[model samples]
Target chain A: AQTVTQSQPEMSVQEAETVTLSCTYDTSESDYYLFWYKQPPSRQMILVIRQEAYKQQNATENRFSVNFQKAAKSFSLKISDSQLGDAAMYFCAYGSGAGSYQLTFGKGTKLSVIP
Target chain B: SQTIHQWPATLVQPVGSPLSLECTVEGTSNPNLYWYRQAAGRGLQLLFYSVGIGQISSEVPQNLSASRPQDRQFILSSKKLLLSDSGFYLCAWSSQPNQPQHFGDGTRLSIL
Candidate 1:
């Protein structure tokens, strides 16, 4: 079974600063996908970014990027120029590209952007 | 242009009462559907997923069950709700395997 681990339960950063959320996963498969989702107080789950394990270039979406180290099994999300809107419960999820369509998620890390 | 809709943004039910939550997707066909339960601060726990109509997969053993009568409609139901079932229920869909899933606003289910 694949399991994702988010070591930091809570993180805080000042507006206009940068923050990184740590994530690691245990999986035997080499080809897979990793995702970061943000859930605000509205309780709406929004996709932040995604990375394919086979790609070493990493994935960047505006202010959000991921440091995907396949060998280390670590996929961390970095938010630059953080805004108040970035405050939310961020989750790291893993998915196998083998047609399972099942996403294993980490516990989550609550991020607070201090204005 | 795909969109997912989850009805009854918020629901409150008494313990032992029957429960129903509906999720439907539009602008796509044969898309994978999933149901997840999010506790207070915990991550989303996948409860059910379907690859096609009438095909459902259960991820956890609980009183809750899921059904997929239509190609794009996924329903979560329970004969008797438990207080433990109180949480935010979310419905999501993906175009293909390992694809990033698009989520609905979600339904907050409170079982008293």
Candidate 2:
């Protein structure tokens, strides 16, 4: 079974600063996908970024980026120029390439942007 | 564009009462559907996933069950609700395995 771990329970960043949320996963499959999702107070689960295992390049979406180290099984999310809207619960997820649509999610890290 | 809808937006039920939550996707066919629950500040816990009609997979044994009667519709049901069942229920859909899933606003289920 695949499991995702988020070490940080809560993180705080100043407005316009940068913050990183760490994530690690345990999986035996060689091919898979990783994702970062955001949920605000509205409780809407939003896709922040995604990274394919086969890709060596990291994934970046606007102010959000991921440092994906496949060998280390670590996928960390970085938020630059953080705004108040960035405050939410961030979750790291893992999915296998073998037609397993289910995503194993980390415990989640609550991000707070201090204005 | 594809969109997923889950209703009702919020639900409150008494303990031992029957519960039903519905999820439907639009502009897609044969897509994979999933049900997840989030407890307060915790991460999503996958409850069930369906690959096709009448094909359902359970990830945890609890007071809940899921069914897929239509290609793009998924339903979560429980004969008797429990206090542990209170959480934000999310419905998501993906075109294929390993693809990014789009989620609905989710249903806030409160079991009293």
Q: What's the CA error at residue B37 for candidate 1, in Å?
A: 0.6
- Per-residue lDDT for B32-76 in model 1, tens only? 999999888788899999999999899999999999999999999
Each candidate's DockQ? 0.89, 0.87
What ranges in model 2 sit over 4 Å off?
Answer: none
How high is the lDDT of residue B70 in model 2? 97
TM-score of each model, paired residue for residue: 0.98, 0.97
The sequence of per-residue lDDT tens digits that candidate 2 reaches over residues B1-112 is 8889999999999999999999999998999999999888688888999999999999999989999999999999999999999999999999888899899999999988
TM-score of 2: 0.97
Docking class of 2: high
The top-ranked prediction according to DockQ is 1
Q: Model 1 — TM-score against the truth? A: 0.98
